[model samples]
Target: MLVKSIEKRVQELNGNLELSLDDIFYTVCQEYNLNAVVIEEALGCKCPFALIGFITTLKSADPGNYIQYKY
Candidate 1:
């Protein structure tokens, strides 16, 4: 859900601005009509990207190496 949502959103953008995870989460949830309880159930820190949702791309380290990836 998050992957497709983020992809669609990125494609729609004019490329002037980037979206933070929170921004994506807020709007995507509204777009999908998801509530807080439902989001918590689906994510709830179950995965690394679970904070906002899931990320579709990883240019550096694997999922286990979040900080390295950030750097």
Candidate 2:
């Protein structure tokens, strides 16, 4: 369940920006506590480029860590 949410969020983030496979994997692991191997296998990317791209996109979209709304 959690993994799915993380994956969805990653996909959403990716959709917003141009992130590499690695960037997505790393961000998922670091921010969402997802397994690297699982994400790699799922995303089919071995390099960190994707994860970097994802992070860059996330950072750009949500700078200063400001919360826009609360659930």
Candidate 3:
């Protein structure tokens, strides 16, 4: 459910950032073999709005690098 919500959000984006928030999420999960649900819930965000703020903050932290729709 968390992954699906994020997918809808990313579909509406321009994808200018090679590494979007969704990418970071999945990568962190895969790289560390963590649980997606547990990690996403920890974020405590509502999709498509506050979530963007979270993403923005992440982008600012590292400049640019996020995406997952390539699959």
Candidate 4:
């Protein structure tokens, strides 16, 4: 269900500005009225890496927010 929640949130926040994985996760939590600790526990990951991996999948699926990099 967490992945579903993430997908939905990413869709909702696709416009305006591109957000980092951490921002997306927090936004999803806020939007769904979920506790961060609860989510982390459910995912068995207390770090941002897990969420970043999920966000990468989301970008591949629905890449509305353009990704860019600078060297």
Candidate that scores best on lDDT: 4
For each candidate in the order shown, give its overall lDDT on alpha carbons.
Answer: 0.45, 0.53, 0.47, 0.55
Error at 52, model 3, angstroms:
18
- All candidates in order of lDDT, best leading: 4, 2, 3, 1
Q: 2-32, model 4: which lDDT tens digit per residue?
A: 5666666666665437776567666665654
lDDT of 3 by residue, 1-71 (tens): 44444445455452546766566555444543434454367466323344435544654464223332233
Comparing 1 and 4 by TM-score, which wins? Answer: 4
Best by TM-score: 4
Evaluated at residue 35, the lDDT of candidate 3 is: 49
TM-score of 4: 0.42
- Model 3 alpha-carbon drift over 4 Å, by segment: 1-16, 45-71
Query: How many backbone clashes can be found in candidate 3?
Result: 4
Segments in model 4 whose C-alpha atoms lie over 4 Å from true places: 1-6, 14-17, 46-71
Which 10 residues in a row give candidate 4 its minimum summed lDDT? Answer: 62-71
Candidate 1's error at 45, in angstroms?
4.5
Relative to the unseen true structure, what is the C-alpha lDDT of residue 39 in candidate 1, on a scale of 0 to 100? 50
Question: Which candidate, 1 or 2, has the higher lDDT?
Answer: 2
